[model samples]
Target: MDLIDRVNEISKRIKTLGTTLQTEEATKNALIMPFIQALGYDVFNPIEVIPEFTTDHGVKKGEKVDYAVTKDNEIIMLFECKKFGAELSPGHASQLYRYFSVSEARFGVLTNGATYMFFTDLDKPNQMDAKPFFTLDMQKFEKQEIDELKKFTKPSFNLDEILNTASDLKYTNEVKKILNAEVENPSDDLVRFFTAKIYSGRLTQPVLEQFRLIVKRAHKQFITDKINERLETALAHPELSVKDNASPSVLLNEVSVELDNGVVTTEEEIEAYNIVKAILRTKAGASRIVMRDTKSYCGVLLDDNNRKPLCRFHFNAKQKYLGLMTDKVETRVPIESIDDIFEHADKLVETLNEYG
Candidate 1:
């Protein structure tokens, strides 16, 4: 299987057997070992993966790390594991940090069998960084994260290549955290920065508070507008839509239906599709919301499933109509213009919830 499939399988295992694990050893046996194996390492081979790997740190004797991964008889990476569900903090990586300075390994990993933190000597030579350059939470991860994780696999492991991007990844992760905090609750400095550019009046406590609320609202609306703009662009260019990955048979069926019914997808119908997609983007991803044009109406489906219809646009006549599927029934709501589709945004989301 591929890296994504293997990672997803491990995720399923964690959800199924996580509660039963109560100790670090059980966690290693059930979760961490599988993760190591998934990286194309031979866990059973002591030459490649040595358990209870020992080294001396300064005056300390026989300091043992959980596992030491070796390549060509040289220690390349060290792992320090904790019990499942245990909160991983910098304190937990103390052993890995010390081992990194003495050993030839350039990378250190601290994991609780669920969240894996990857550390390297980026800040100082032969010294592990206080914060990890990259982190992976198995419970929730994206494809891009999986791709990054692949770089550490046995066949693809490259010391120089990883170090090249480590600095940028570390800084980017920190910046995203700061941006998320500022977006939700703008800091005084952030508020002042915006206020100075937009307002010439002197800053006061009341004005600061007023601008705080304004900044928060403006930030939220700006994000919404950007999402809507992208959705509209994707609708205008159907080739850009991720939903075009449908199977050949499904594509053939749609084409045949359109041909038989003499379907002509108009600009108004496409606009209605865009509006409906933007409303349900939070509930269901934009890619899962599909537009299937037919002679009678333009159908918006969930995962391209006809039975799970989200809504439809009937713009072939003088009076436009929106067909909302609720309670397994199509309810035609009459409207004067395509913009009226926004009136039933809640109903569209509710329809999607019914499928769940």
Candidate 2:
């Protein structure tokens, strides 16, 4: 199986057995060990994967990390494990951090069976960064996250190649976190910046409060407008709708219906497809969900069957709509952004269950 399948397998185990795992050792045997094996490492091989690997820090003896992964007779990665369902924090990585400085490992992982946090010496050489360069949650992950995890596999492990992208991934993750927070609740500085640009009056408590709400609404509308612009562009140029090396099962079909007619599949539509797939992933495999674009809307089907219509993206117009089927009747619900599809997750799942 590929990385996605392997990762999904682990996800299934977590969902099914997570509650039963009561101890740290049980968590390791049930979830963490299989994850190591998924990365093409032999957990039983002491040479490749050392259990309870010990490293000594200055004036500290026998400081042990959960596991140490070696390649070519050299330590390549370190791991620290916590019990199932435990909330992982930077404090949990102390032993891993100490091991990183002493060992030749370039990567350190802290996991609680479900969430894996990958740390590297991006901030300083031989010292693990306080923040993780990449984080993977077994229960919740995207295709791009699986792609990133694939690079760490035994076959594809390249120190320089991963380091090249680690900096960008680390900073990008941080920036996105900050941006998400700002979008949800505009910071004082962010509100003031927008206020200066648009408001002519003096900055007062009342004005600041007023601008805070305005900034929030403006951000939402701005995002919606940008999505509409992309949809318009894709509709104008149907040829550009086809992505290079696109996954047929995940995103676009091998020969999309768009090619038969003038219908164009926008990137936003592809994003919506992925979102729907993620929502119904546990109920239905991603391969079962297929994108079949039409001139009016982009239809997502189960098992490539029109009778099994899951949802549709009606993005050809100014106001986007998510076409959901219930009792064989289509409901075109108006949505501002692709993220809004998550709101009707139960309805989407219900539609899929009807077919089953």
Candidate 3:
């Protein structure tokens, strides 16, 4: 199978068996090793992928990393594994850090079998960076993230090529996070800076508050417009429209009805669904997590039926609420950010397993 198919299969396995991966060794055998296998590496072959690979050197003898990937007898990557559900921090990557110094490994990955963080010596030579340059949450894979991961797959692996762009990717990801925060809740400095560009105003408290509201509204409007444009592009294909050659019953209205253009799912709803999917992906496959939309609200169902509602998005107005249907009853919860869906993991899982 191709890389995308491989990832999808791994995703399904995580959902189907995540709870059972309670121990560190179990995590390695199930999640971590499968990831290595998906990366076009051979987990069965010790020549390429070494298990319990020792990075023992100097005073730190017998210190072993979970795995070491070698290319032509040259160590290329070192992996440090943790138990499933373990919180990953830089401190957890210390084993890989020490291994990077003694071995010729260029990349070090720290993972809890769910979250993988790729580290390299971008800041200084012979020392791994305190922060990872690339991070992938296996539960939430995107097209861009998949493209980034394709770079590390064995067939395309290149040390110099990755090094050349690692610095930029690291800085760009950080900048994106900052910009996301500013868009959601702009700071005083950011507000003033933008306000100065569009409005000639002093940094007074009342003026600052007014401009903040304007900026926030404008940003939301801009995002909404972009979403609409994309939706139009995806749904409104002229070729698919009824032409003069069509039968009288196959009119434009008929085609529109077939497309269900009237009951379009908004981008906000799609994002909310994706967030819910991300939260529950480790416990269920994508096929089982279905989203259905209507004019009133977007209903995300577990088995493509309303009786098995997973969550619902109510985004018909400025103030949006998420309906937690874990109890199969609409429990409205205020949602200001898309990240809030992650907070209901237990509820989602309980609801899903109960239905199953």
Candidate 4:
């Protein structure tokens, strides 16, 4: 299987089996090992993937990480793992922090099986960053993220390449998350920033609220229009795009170049995702409602998974349809706009109740 498929298969394992995994050893065996294997590593090869990999720090003897990945008999990365559901603190990565500089490794990974944080020496040379350079939610799989993780695979591992972009990726992800939050519920200052461009009126509460929705709509529209524009351009002239012979990293850049850059989600789809979450917040916790987007449709599930979706979004087409499932029956409800999500509130809850 390809890296995305392999990691996605493991993602399924995490969604279903992770909550049931009760101990550190079980996480190591069931989650961590498979993750290592999915990265094209030989879990059985002690020389390549050393279990209980040790590093000595003066009086601290037998200081070990769970696994140490090597190339050419030299350690490139160290991994420390915690049991599933265990809260990972800096203390959990203490050994990794201590071992990072001591060992030849430049990268360190701290994970609780489901959430992985990658650390490196961005702030200080050879010292592991107090904050992780990159983080991954195993259950919340993103193709671009999986592609980035593929850099660490046995076949593609390159220290210089990973380190060179580590700083940029770290800050870029942080910025995207901040922008994403602003897009959902813009800050008053942000609203004012846009209001200044159009209005000369006083900054009042009602005006702020009025401008917030407009700002959000404009942002969403901007993204949607840009995406449509690029898609049209690419469709019209595929050769004008990045060549097939371009390097994987160059190809990776092509994806992030777009504003609505999600592999599965679009600007409108994210708005829909938020609306679905808001509606289902009362039915069950918002955390339980997972959105998985595929080529054909975006599947919304109550942990029912892609196999048995609670609903699907056919938003790609001109006429948007919300596919709802209830009592072993599936039905598609056409909607004029994303605002129509609330109209199907009763049906949304019914499917959750049926599958709950």
- Compare the candidates by TM-score and give the number of the best one: 1
Model 3 Cα lDDT, one tens digit per residue, 196-243: 998865678999999898888887776666545444554675422332
> Which residue pairs in model 2 clash with each other?
none
Candidate 1 weakest lDDT stretch, 10 residues:
242-251
Whole-model lDDT, candidate 1? Answer: 0.85
Q: What TM-score goes with each of the models?
A: 0.67, 0.66, 0.65, 0.64
Q: Which portions of model 4 miss their true places by more than 4 Å?
A: 89-91, 227-356
Off by over 4 Å in 3: 236-356
Residue 89 lDDT in model 2? 86
Lowest summed lDDT over 10 consecutive residues: which window, candidate 2?
248-257
Model 4 vs. true fold: TM: 0.64
Top lDDT prediction, candidate number: 2
Q: Is candidate 2 or candidate 3 better by TM-score?
A: 2
Off by over 4 Å in 2: 228-356
> Using alpha carbons, what is the TM-score of model 2?
0.66
lDDT of 2: 0.85
Compared with the true structure, model 3 gives a TM-score of: 0.65
Model 1, backbone clash pairs (residues 3+ apart or across chains), number = 0
Please report, as a residue range, the 10-residue window in candidate 4 with the lowest summed lDDT: 243-252
